[model samples]
Target: MPYPIVAAVVATMVLLGIYLSTAAPDLTFWDATELMAAAHTMGIPHPPGTPLWVLVGKLASMLFSSAAPPRAITLLSVWSAALTGGAAAYMAARWLGARGAVVAAVSAGTMLTVWNNATETEVYALSLLVSVLLLVTGEFAGRPDTDDHERRRARALMAFVCGLAVPLHLTVLVALPAAVAFAWRGPRPVWREVVAWVALAALGLSAIAVLPLFSAQNPTLDSGNPESWRALVSVLRREQYAVAGLWPRQAPLWLQLGNVFQWSDWQVAYGLHPFPTAHPVRTALTVLWAWLAVLGLRRLWRHDPRVGRAMLLLVLSASLGVALWLNMRAGPTFGVGLLPKGTPHEARERDYFFVLAFWGWGLLAGAGLSAIASALGRRLPAPVAMLPLALVVVPLLANRAVADRSREPVASLPRTYARLLLDAVPRRGVLFAGGDNDSFPLWYLQQVEDYRPDVTVITVPLLGAQWYRERLAAQQLLEVAAVARWPGQGAVLRSLVIHAEGARRAVRVSTLLERSDRLQLDPGGGWALQGLVYAPDRQLGAGQTGLDLPALRRQRSMVPMGALAPLPPGADPAAQTAQELLQCTQVLGPADSLLVSGCGGV
Candidate 1:
């Protein structure tokens, strides 16, 4: 079979698998829903904002008329990314040919960041697609044989696409250096052609201004308010740390440099610092693939300085952009708090320009592999020369094929939880859920039922105590006990509490069983109750579990029990909840052996 055909097949299968696995009723765990919600509403005022990409999602949702708007947007993104991958492969093949292109395409498809973003409603895929187009067109325009008309056309196209790209992601700025290099390389161009190219480039670059025009929900100057501006400035000032360290205070220059060289290695082998357990297998493969790509670029540099220079510029620009974006958005702080505390910020931050790094590196790797095989091609029989190449190709393709199948079920967890909560709680009742990785449950329920106006979904501090308190007062119920509440009318005293200190708090689960008699034991020996909590906890079962049903019913009809289970020592039952509430006169104090009334009614 032709190498192009094989590359197409591999790319298609990989994309299809990702789309199928991820397309569902809810959002991916990584706050994709928050972005989708903003996208659906065409609001750009939020952080990590992507005005152009959100518009694309909104348009697709309207066009398809699908009930699952986010899924539709995600599917569209996947398709676009797949096409981008194909275009990239074609370009690589055109530049390096056959074997090199196949390696590039396969490497891209297997890339953890690329595959992950393809299934999300983020701008990463769109940015990647536009970047690939820009690179390819720039390459074509720089060709020595290209005519004035063709070069002008390519320049205009590049400008228009770049213009469209800027609002989607600010990182598109990285392409400018590459563009300048390409424009300067070709034969002495006609002055008229140069003027046209410059004019088009300016026009394309202007599209970034439109970002502020999109609804106030976008991350532009209009929506962020004075504080947002302050945050942006704060982030900008820390640009050095953003690219180098976990935080400004603790960052060391040497360490940051080490991180850059060994980032792929560290991310894959040890994983990222906060989410150390994140996609280990993918991380490892990415590191290996990236290293190989660097090798390829080194070999190509000796022969094609232009290609080498272009690759180097693109990689450095994109890497710096991504690192800075991640730093600003994820935070100079280490661990999970690296990202902003809100869903909106998380959604936006997740679209860092790292995929560009992956692409540049992948191309370099393909070039490297091709150069190696070509060297052997001169001395050995054709089949013998191909043997080493085959070994590398088969494993990579297989890895991509396998990795494509490993996507997390974005829709399943939130949808299932929503169903369970909807069925478990009264139509008008408020549910207090502990920790949610993605904001999917809230968004999915809002889409299916108009209950968002009535239903309150809170995620501890990320949801903010003030907001949670306000919602609790309005709803007249506290669904989750993990949240801390100030003294208030609508607030009920919790009997049992669970809190996880540090980053684990994000994953901690808190449940409030309205009635103790309703509790049942599951086959796995985990307690089954009216409400289930999912929070981050160092010691799994150490938090306050058993609630006094009889006392709870007698004293407070709507009893709210919370557990603050920190890392090692755990929460002292007498100090955290029981005594704390007693001081507020909300608890039935000095009561021993409270009698159990029948589990009468919910």
Candidate 2:
């Protein structure tokens, strides 16, 4: 096949793969939470991290229902990746010739990292797409013979695109050095034109920052008070500090530097341990891309001495620096010490590999493809020349198949749990959970069933004293006495106990499981109490007493079973009920205790 025809086919396959993969499932973490929150309110809040994406998601949801919004937004992400890939292909073809374009197109289209993000709601893919476009435009305008006016126009457009990407994700700012270099290589423009272009770019980018400012002015955009703006600013500053290696007591600089490449290994072994099969293709591609990157750098240094050498060096330094910064901010080495243990943030430090690997793979593959084509010209028949194309095409098809299987459409726990909780709870009561996990449940239930004003689902972590002081100011949840045990001895009548058996054993489960009771069976085949419970007269420790069978029978308003006999199957007389009472609550003896409950002002 002709090189252009081959590139077109490959690009089309990539786009189809991205669309199908994204359509298959909702794999992105925190996506539901951010979208739901945005749907209910106007301005962006803390946590969900990407304000721009959230705003866009909210708009999408408004146009369509929440159920359909995610898929629609995912489609947009797919298109963005395809467009970026095409731009990379064009740049390669223009710079290195037809063979280079074919290599670049295949490499970018088949890249696992880009494909992974294309099927999710994360902002990285969008940022990367914009970055590639800027680079391509810059490269095109940098030709020595390009007229000054044309160069000025091209530089201005590049600046504008970079500026638009800034608010979408602050990390895109890392590409500024490359952008500046691109512009400097071109013919000098009049000072006035440079100033004018800079201002236009700033204005376009500043459009994103304006949302927060507008929110500050209109407090009604969110539920919080005016002071919430200050909190938002503080959080943004902290994030910037963390990302820039300015966070205090961070890991040593050397370890942070090494973390970028090693991060993928850590993520697979530790982050997603039990689910090792989740992203096999992505893992393999990451390693392959890294190897090719090193090889590509060597080749650039040897043959393509000027522009290629500079590009290789710049990519390496920038990638290393960015990787170090992300590692410190994420603090993955501390294991589960951070808040929201096992969240995507803790695992995503490895995401930098996507961009780094794609560039490396493209450049190296371009060089290799060019060489092979040259060698085949004299020895191989024309028909056999298509074999090299097949080599690139097959892996891409396999990659797409793997990507499709790895994603699950209804895979989100938050959406499932939220729906379940909403159904279980009473219409006029509150349901409390441990952390930000509660946010999604609350937002979804309220939006889906209109349960907000009547039924509230409170998250304990967000209600803590420190959280209130920082985000809520003096208006904080009212804390009652810190009762030590459970069914709490207090007079609070109604409570829904949700015991997440799976979560209790994990590291850093305390914030969520701290005040809950733990029940277990003894080795001797009797019930065993594992935690304490509060009572009116005393703090009942575990295994302190047997269950009050007669009292429980009376509570049930029925006859009691005699002695310690087990309840007979299908003999459901109230007489057999008392024996099963102990099993219901998992009480070992009369003195066993239960969990407690209370509420606070906010």
Candidate 3:
């Protein structure tokens, strides 16, 4: 077999082994659950609708149907990551040779951000794959010795792939100009062929049409419901998330820029993080890694300047350009803007956005290490001289403690919460969920696993939308005007609970709303304890004040909660349950202690 093909296959197998060994056994929090459920049902996800991933994930889900629904869907990310490692290895091998391939593989494969993306159903893993492939393809297409016809074919292929990224995620736009320029090579542009390639690229972008196509069928979790031309345009343009043209800045520009380095410093020595625990060691390793990357990039410029220059542009576009574009709010600051008292923030860290940038830097570091090996050739044997490249594997080892999800307790929390809550809600009830974690898992369990299909889950955040309101009004048999009349989200929710009561159905709310000041759940005001969730019907209490230990135990037995048992007091909100339960809500037993600690805020 050809060397590049062999290199890709060998690297893919090795990395896939590591990735699968640590892959989440079930669906996870954030977008992973929603995307998995959407793929399984051929439904739509949030804005711009990620149709390409939906189609691809659908196939993976079917092929791996024997696994749990979330785990099956998560395989897509695992494969994308493995393929990414393969591409990185091949790219490094092109200039750094076999030893360079090892350095690049170790650096890219186990970088904390990249590994995190690999374990779940998320877009960035696949986005990183395509971006790396573009670098490889553009490098080949940029070769001066390549035949004209072949080069044009390669460039045309590059254009179509680039177009596919439109639906994948617009983040790829930063990598575009560099990739296109490199593919142009020495040939003077052929206008007619260029136009034809552009047309073909548009055709690839049309993959997004799956949003309207599948949406018209009205799947269970149609996020935007972009079935009509107008709605489709709105979804495609991302008007729902459009924040007045990416400015009026979400965070101070300096803090946002500072996050670029903040994210970078964590890549190689991520295990020593929550930093300051081993600050000196972390800083030294990070500096050494950066120094090697700069050296490698410099050597590449002196040797293969054409490709080297394009790569620097690609890395900058992927990292710094992305940081500016994202303009995210304060996310896990390392003393920079530590007190940005009143700024919007991301729900979670956004380091995954820079996977392409970090992965590219790893390849450069591999080349730089090879350059060092050459410099010491006279002093050391050829095989022995290259031993220093093995040191690059330090990142893979350092990050493993944090990045490995195989036995991580929090990784399985989403699945556990979804299953427990779904099983606990009374049949044909209305479950009002508070946030992404509180709501998405229910949707996945209902639509994909066919669990508690009769229950109506109303996500609180989406209630403000007219379409969402109308859908709820229709499903629950409420008057449209009455549904719209609610003065605020709190009012809208109270109405839903009352409506469920009138219709002889049970009412429940995720812990967020229950703990919130939004509703009147003061004992006499129609609310009862329902294990992990809260039932809003005073009737079920039967004079009870604490949890139903038996019910909680049954729910616990049904799902695998991983290693952690009974979250301790004052745990993070994502891991907490029943805020009011914290008022000395005494523990029942180890088995039912998910939130039984009765003194925390999840």
Report every candidate's CA lDDT: 0.49, 0.46, 0.72
> What RMSD value applies to candidate 1?
11.9
Best by lDDT: 3
Worst 10 residues of 1 by lDDT: 563-572
Number of clashing pairs per prediction, in order: 42, 24, 4
Model 2 lDDT per residue over 1-602, tens place: 55544554555456656556544244233444444445445555443234566566556556545445445556556666776666666556544456556565656555555555666555666677777767766665765667777888888887787667645666565555655554566546779877887897887566555455545654322322223566455544544223444565255556555445444332212222222233565456445555544654455455434446546645654567565555453434433453364543342335444464444455555455554554565798956764554445433554554334223222343343344334333344444444444455456446534554454444443442233322322212222222222223121111212111122211111112233321111111211122111111113343232233433333223222222244222121221222332223333344333212211000
TM value for model 3: 0.88
Instruction: Indicate whether candidate 2 or candidate 3 has the larger TM-score.
Output: 3
Give the Cα-based TM-score of candidate 2 against the true structure: 0.66
lDDT of 3 by residue, 1-602 (tens): 65666667777887898889888898677788899888999988888788998898899988888988888888889999999888877766766665567566667777778888898789888888887777777777887778888888878878888789888887666677668656756667679988978987998898988888898898877877788888788777777665444777766778777777777777888677644233677778888888888888887787677877887888888887887777777675433446555655666667777888887777677667777887777698988887777777788788777666666455666676677677768888777777788788888888877878898887777776665787878776455775547566656666676677889987766655535532432334433344556554445433233455565555546545342365432123455442232222233533444443352222
lDDT for each residue of candidate 1 in 203-302, tens digit (9 for 90 to 100): 7656444444553333311222213444344322433123434555233334333334433432222222223233556465556666677777787577
Evaluate candidate 3 by giving its C-alpha RMSD to the native, one decimal: 4.2
Error of 1 at 569 (Å): 28
Model 1 segments more than 4 A misplaced: 1-26, 39-45, 62-70, 187-250, 253-263, 266-291, 324-353, 391-411, 421-426, 429-440, 448-453, 458-530, 533-602
Candidate 2 deviation (Cα RMSD): 11.6
Using all chains and alpha carbons, the TM-scores for the candidates as numbered come to: 0.62, 0.66, 0.88
Quality of model 2 by C-alpha lDDT: 0.46
Report clash pairs, candidate 3: 296-368, 573-602, 576-602, 582-598
Residue 224 of model 1 has an lDDT of 28
